[model samples]
Target chain A: MDLVDFARGPALKAAFIIFILGIVWRIVNVLLLRHKRILSEPRRSVPVALLAGLKGTGSRSWPHPEFIKRTVTGEALGYSYHIGLFIVILLFAPHIIFFGSFIGARWPALPNSVVTIFAVITITLFVAVLARRLGHPVLRHLSNFDDFFSWFVVALLLVTGLMATAHVGAPYHTILGLHILSFDLLLIWYPFGKLMHAFYIFPTRAVDGYVMTRKGAPS
Target chain B: MNTSPVDFQANLAPEEAKLGESARVAGAMRGFAREIGALSALRLDACVHCGMCADACHFYIVTEDPQYTPVLKVEPFKQVFKREAGAFAPVFRWFGLKAKITGAELARWQHLLYDSCNLCGRCSLMCPMGIDIAELIEQARRGMFEAGLAPKELYEKAAHQRRTGQPEPSDEPYRDKLLAIGRRFNVEIPLDKPRAEVLLTVPRTDIEHYPAAVAALVRVMAHLKADCTFRSDGLVAENYGYYAGGRDWQREISRRLIDQAVACQAKVLIVPECGHAYSALRWEAAELMGKSLPFKVLHITEYLAEALEAGRLRLRTAQVGATAFHDPCQLVRKGGITAAPRQLLRAMGIEPRETVRHIGYNICCGGGGGVFDIERAATLRHRVVEEKFHEIDQTGAQTFLTTCSDCRRTFDDGKKRFNWELTPGSLLELVAEHLQGG
Candidate 1:
């Protein structure tokens, strides 16, 4: 089979299956594990706790005041790239087309140039994140195989996807196939790696906020 | 360096001295495996390894040591979870990618979990992913305890609590001390008063070293005309099992009070100004006992705040000068006693000044998590205290007010050792001293 045919037919189908099933498996495996019962009477009402948790999902995105003095650069870079990744993945015109084909859903996407700019920013920030991981002593010690590997995979996916869209480094059809293949690899790796944070962060932050707020702590 | 915090080292038997490294590793792994339930499993999985927690941890912020980073402290446990409990465990095992946990490795982890971490929960607060690093460390401590890798002071303290059901160093009956202090103050200290409205418990440290503070609590109880009693059976509030990371011992220590409160038919169980004591009772006791307590659990500050809020307790509105409130890690950050002390101070007509970091974000006094009792951690503890000392200094307050007795004692130690000018005092004591009428 030609590269384009293989990429579109079997490889994409496999990626789709793996992406869906892997995420389901991870969420189930984690959610189903038995937790110790919280026996203390919650200090506040359950609704208040839930509200606090909801508040925390947005509030925890920013660092505490003490850390804010020194962490503005890191925080800005992190938020910019994460937001960029979201736009490039869901709001890009090509991605919407792909989604329309798979799930029969449609939405307007950002202009191709805008998508390309986001891709460039994401790739640059990904490189900077890796540099910080390696150069900063604390980050270096905390960085593991999962961290570096996830960074590499996502960066490669963005670069290839941008190249496919911009018609650079190869013929458009060939670059698109390469981009699909790289994304397929990322899909298979997502649920098993640190990329699972995308799904887990909000729920975890909410639960923490709920508990803290129930105790009448500042959430 | 400093003398061993306890005498456990001198009495270490030959067999105890020579650790079975493999068995200890297995034991630690078993503890980890047992404790890795859904919530902990989720927390373990959520970490992005961004090292933002380092900024939150006073241990790392003060020392600038990468190893002391909060996230790094839990790295080994995360590896264990990935290899044994993760969805891709079989793949990890097939590739032989799992690092082997050894006894010596666990021995080193003892320092990270106990000495460096105060279980302050600040890292959990800082985490964008809400990874509960302090709770994870508390669980990891259980694994260390199971492996017999806990610090000597911790083990000894736990053993002492197991044997005596109290943390008092002396053989003197605590009842006698309470009675003598009550007699000196001419306050009727009721012992084993059945069906009392409140069951007041004191830490052994309060009875021995801070009897005046204990007297203040008694005087406050009397002034409120509350039906409170101090039971000789479970009077001590400090739970060394918590400090030692021994889950069974913690449960045992907590159970003594639970059973007593149940027997006395008390309406409120008053926890002393001991940090971990408040945590052990106000948070962990109910979980350990497998039920919500029949009686309400309140730290003295929480009780005072409630009374003031309810218009039950009246203060004389004495001006104590510019005072700064030190939020005890366990009491404020962990227990949510944030506004109570502030409210109590205001009730006394003292507008307390805020430290640079106050309430939930306050820095630890550098002697929590039983680090004060670990001689090996003395130097590091001293260094971290300097960070807090600077914060206290910035407030420019002459007197430091804290609710937890452990924080109070640590500040006293820091004040004496570092020649700090601020006076260390308890919030309850301040309130008692400024009561409207006695």
Candidate 2:
């Protein structure tokens, strides 16, 4: 089969199915686990605790002031690349066209030049983050195969997408097919790897905040 | 006084090292899998490992050790969770990637789970992903305990508590010493009172080493003319089982207090100036007992703050010099009794000079989570305490005050060792000294 046919047919379909089902299965399995109830009387009401939970989901996106003072570079690089990746994946015209094909929905896309800028900034930040992870002792100790593999897959996706957009390396369909295949690989790896953080972060923050706020602490 | 941290005597008889090599790893893995409930499972799954939490940990912040990172400390737990219960467990097992925790591994993790960590919950506050790393560390301790790999000091303490209902095994008898303290203070400590508005209890350490702390509570109660009694049957506020990670014994210890409070018809059960004791009673006791407690649970600081706020207790201005208050990890950070001690200081007409990190963000005293009881942790404890000492010194206060007895003891040790000029004092003792006359 041709690269385009394989990328659009078996690979895309398999990756999409696995990605959705894997995420849904993981979420369901986790939610189905027994939750040890807080038997003690909470200092705050349930509504108040839930509100605190929601607040924590937003507030924890920013590091604490003390941490920010020490980790300004890490935090800035981390957020910049994350926001850039979000925009490049969802808001770029070609990406939106793909999204429209997949989800039957598409919003107005950013201009190609702007998307190119985001891709460059994101790629740069990703490299900086990878270098820091390799350099910093704590991060190095915390990192493992999953961390590196996830970084590698995401970086490959970005590079292939950029290559397709710029038409610099190969024929347009060939580059595009490679980009789609790279993304497919990433989606297949997503639910099993650290990429699941994209889905778990908000609920995790909410639970933490609810528990802390119920004890009368500002989470 | 011996200047060496290791020179201190062990509080309990040393436990025998009798763990075998068989199924201990399986036992630990089972415990880890069992303890990973919905919340903690999410925590295990959600760690992005940015290492920002390292900045928040007292051990990592002071020592700069990569292994001491809060996220790193939970590695063993994560490994077990991944091998047995993770989404890719089958793949991990098939590829020989499973990292089963062995007896030796558990022994090494004793330092990570016990000595180095105070389970202070500061890292929980710092995580951008909002992982409760401290709570996960506690579960790791539990898993270690299940594998018969807990520190001998903690097991001995828990054993002593289980057998004698006191924190340590004493030759002189703890009940007699407690009664002597009540007699020395010329106060009626109605032990096992049939009914009382408040059931007051103290840690065995307070009765043995700091009887003055117990006496101060009595004096404050006398001044307030409050209906309170010390039940001899459930006198100890400290929960060694909770510290040792023995869930059953922890429940047994808590049940002693719960049964006593229920039998006494206590409207309020006041835990002494011990942080973990307060946590065991106020937070974990009901959960361990599988039901809500019949009476209210309050740390001594909380009770004092509430009394002052309710206009029942009054304090004369303290004559001491400017003081800095240390917030205990369990009481202030984890337990959320932040405002009580601060408000009490304000009520005494003495404004406490605040530390650089104060209130909910206060650093651990380096001796919480039973670290003070571990002799091997002494060097690390003393070393990391300098950070708190420097922060307290920056406040320029002549005296240091804290609500938790363990924090006070830790600071006192650091003060004497470093020859720091600051005098460590307890809020309970300070209140007793300045109670309004009847």
Best by TM-score: 2
- Maximum-DockQ candidate: 2
Candidate 2 TM-score, true structure as reference:
0.96
Error of 2 at B268 (Å): 1.2
Worst 10 residues of 2 chain B by lDDT: B1-10
Task: State each model's CA lDDT, in order.
Answer: 0.82, 0.84
lDDT of 1 by residue, B1-438 (tens): 100111222222233346687777887888788788888888888888878888889988897888887877775677788788887777777898776676665665767887788899888888879878898998888887777777878788778787787664675788888999899877778788877989999977788778888899999998888898999888898888898878888999889888888898998999978888888888888898788889899888888888888989988876667888888888878887777888888887778888788788888998888888787788888888888899888987877888778788888888888999888888888888888866
Question: Tens-digit lDDT track for model 2 on B1-438?
Answer: 000111222232334355466666766776687688788788999988788888889898888887788888777788887777776678777897865566665666677788888889989889999998999999888887777767778888888897778877677777688889889877666676788999988877678778888888888887888798877788888899988888888999889888889988999999889898988888888998889998999888888888898999888888777889988888877888888988788888889898888888888889989898898888899987888999999998987888778887888889888998887788899899888873
What would you estimate as the lDDT of candidate 2? 0.84
Clashing pairs in 1: B273-B405
Question: Cα RMSDs of all predictions?
Answer: 3.5, 3.9
Candidate topping lDDT: 2
lDDT of 1 by residue, A103-146 (tens): 89999999989888989988888888888888988877767778
Chain B alone, TM-score of each model? 0.94, 0.95
